[model samples]
Target: MNEPIISVSGLRGVVGGSLAPDVAMRYVAAFSAVAPAGAIVVARDSRPSGRMLASAVHATLCALGRPALDAGVAPTPTVGVLVRRLGAAGGIQISASHNPPEYNGLKLFGPQGRLLTAAEGEQVLAQYRHSGPAWVPYDRLGGWQEIEDPLGPHLDAVLSVVDAGLIRSRHFHVVLDANHGAGGALGRRLLEALGCRVTLLGEAADGQFEHPPEPTAENLAGVGAAVASAAADVGFCLDPDADRLAVIDEAGRYVGEEYTLALCVAHVLADRRGPVVTNCSSSRMTADLAQRFGVPLVRSAVGEANVVSAMVQCGAVFGGEGNGGPIDPRVGLVRDSFVGMAHILAAMARRGLPVSRLVEELPRYEIVKTKMTLQRHRVPAALDALEAHFSGARADRLDGLRLDWPDRWLLVRPSNTEPIVRAVAEAKTRHQAQELCDQAAQVIAALG
Candidate 1:
């Protein structure tokens, strides 16, 4: 039997092969057994498989004597909010993130509307292995309910963080590409509320993607051209689940996802100075902003849960990942694309500068990423060889092998699921960044 790839926060796998109804039910039962007895909020993206999985999740929760509160199709972050708002025991989001359509997964949240910590996640895993849910008596089975306006409160909370009035007055022309995901539901409302003359692409919530769903520069070529042709001020593209976001400048240049967090941090820090947190893989521009504002910046491992954990520990006002996941403490702990959009628009409106100019004003850096195949057992030897080759560079094993230079850095780590060593570098120029990755790959290859 195929097994799902379960992690601390949730599980993900290819549909039909590894992610069948039976496997999903078992995990749901495990989660229900461990969670406090209360209504559990459930939401999903616009994936074709989401409806089927949602039904399965509901059945499992009901059978375990836990009421299921369905939020229907919504972003992952929205599910987190509804969980807190309705006082649910926890929440489940059905999304594979930026993975292909063939892949789908479930993300679990705690009662406080946060993803489970490492300790809490271990408890759920143990329950899954043990395989016994404390089912209530036949007369005490949990009930089910549906929520019609899950996005309303989320929209209000996001708008409160930014100057909606100012953004509306600017009358900016905006282009939004939802790619037929759940984002279209709220993305349209947020844009309209901001009073922008909006042109939407792939607005249907049908899970039919016009292009690849990741929102990377290469995949956003059509969005770039649409921005230029529409003569809009900027373009926004969201992944299949809407948890991640990428931007295109007014000039039709893909500014990339790395700037999503940096741009929002710059805006927030300009008004209020406070601590910021991000994963180790985030760009150095975020660090530069913290330095300019004299605010502390903390780094965590490369994951939303890690970043959120550090943010709470450090009392950070803002935190996110370089992959377009911006987490605003005011909104929720999860990375929210809607918050990023609202903040960027508010910043542009206040400064009265074009999106292109605003991007140019910030510190710039280039990042190059590459991966190499290696057996899992050989990772230790590869790390030793890499450290020896780059003897002059400062070495740190916070998450993996990280070599730091005065103005550049390279991170060599193994993929969580694949048998490949991932290498990432950031430098002052694109060539320099690529060179760093190439040098690391060459050193690792020589060891093999």
Candidate 2:
């Protein structure tokens, strides 16, 4: 807790606490050290600390003699798209994603427009802990420039994957809850391009969040009512960095994040039969869809990097985590909220169904998540005990301990960003899911 959570995935910390200008600078320096010989695109979400961190990151890049292509206040996926479109060596997004405002962090992208793989992250971490910044002299210092059109490439890429003409023809009304994160500008543009009559909430690209920024059911409770009040056809709520999405139907129903990927996957696979990938901790809805489509369902460990790695291995056409991030390979290889909104609207326009009706077509399941704080050394034994306690169920140790049954499942994994263990369960009903988590909790508690 005293230090930022640094990993290959990214670095996140409390703005004034574990995260500061120097921390941001050193992390960027490490990235610069390993990045290829080209400019590095830097961006941030609409957090207050983002301005401070962006300054330090640009300074670090310039000091290291790496040109800083600054795209101020863009979505996470937009940063990725800019990196590839601009032909940069890499990209860095200064946002803590769905974390609270007090938290801000960096997410790295490779030249391929994907999050740094675990191996690539290890290389970066080694530089951070072991090497000092390679400061340059005055003559060799790097330069900085601002990008003029950050959202255009990202918007065009997302619009390309969906039927823009058909969606525009529907002229559906939409409610966008950006919650003052970096999603508003690009999200608004994408919706307007699709010809949606927009009721945009928290449209400002400031850190002034009206609600919590995660876009969960609890965080987005008011969005459902807002959607109904606007008489909109659908509501799309985006997380802070705009990589994830959560939906609300016209009936004021929170269709939830898990359904985001499932809905998009089902829609894509209905037309194109290719392998689909999701994380192990995601809902079984994706697995069911892959089965229904007679395609392979590949479950990677829980992380965007892991999912992308699995996707590349399987050549998955459509993939995402359970967290409302659907990845269409046609778009840049990142978890994109724009991709979700466009595809969901296209699904509605093509099928002539409401968001809720489209949701009903998919098989339903309930998911429950709980956590416990245990020392790091005890984790393996704890998982072993849970595995033994649920001997009848199948177990998988891909990222953590996962026990599977026909209709329900439980996953126990250590938090990569927090000092706790997370246990998730899903089943046909909420009670069934809760019971599974409770059983797992008892097993994990008995270990202590």
After superposing candidate 1, which stretches have Cα over 4 Å from the reference?
A: none
Off by over 4 Å in 2: 417-419
For all candidates, the clash counts are: 0, 0
What overall lDDT goes with each candidate model? 0.91, 0.92
lDDT of 1 by residue, 172-242 (tens): 89899999988987998999999988898999988899998999989999899999999999999999889
> Model 2 compared with the native: what TM-score?
0.98
Candidate 2 lDDT (Cα, whole model)?
0.92
**Residue 359, model 1: Cα distance from true site in angstroms:** 0.8
Task: Please give the lDDT score at residue 445 for candidate 2.
Answer: 80
Positional deviation of residue 147's Cα in model 1 after best superposition, in angstroms: 1.7
Candidate with the greatest lDDT versus the true structure: 2
Model 1 scores a C-alpha lDDT of: 0.91
> Model 2, range 1-448, lDDT digits (tens) per residue?
3779998978999988899888888888889888789999999999988998898998888898889899999999998899889999999999999888899999999999999999999999999999989899999999999999889999999998888999999999999999999999999999999999999999998899999888878888889998988889999999989999999999878999999998898789878999999999999999998999999999999999999999999999999999999998889789999999999999999999999999999999999999988777889999999998899999999989999999989999998766789999999999999998888888888886
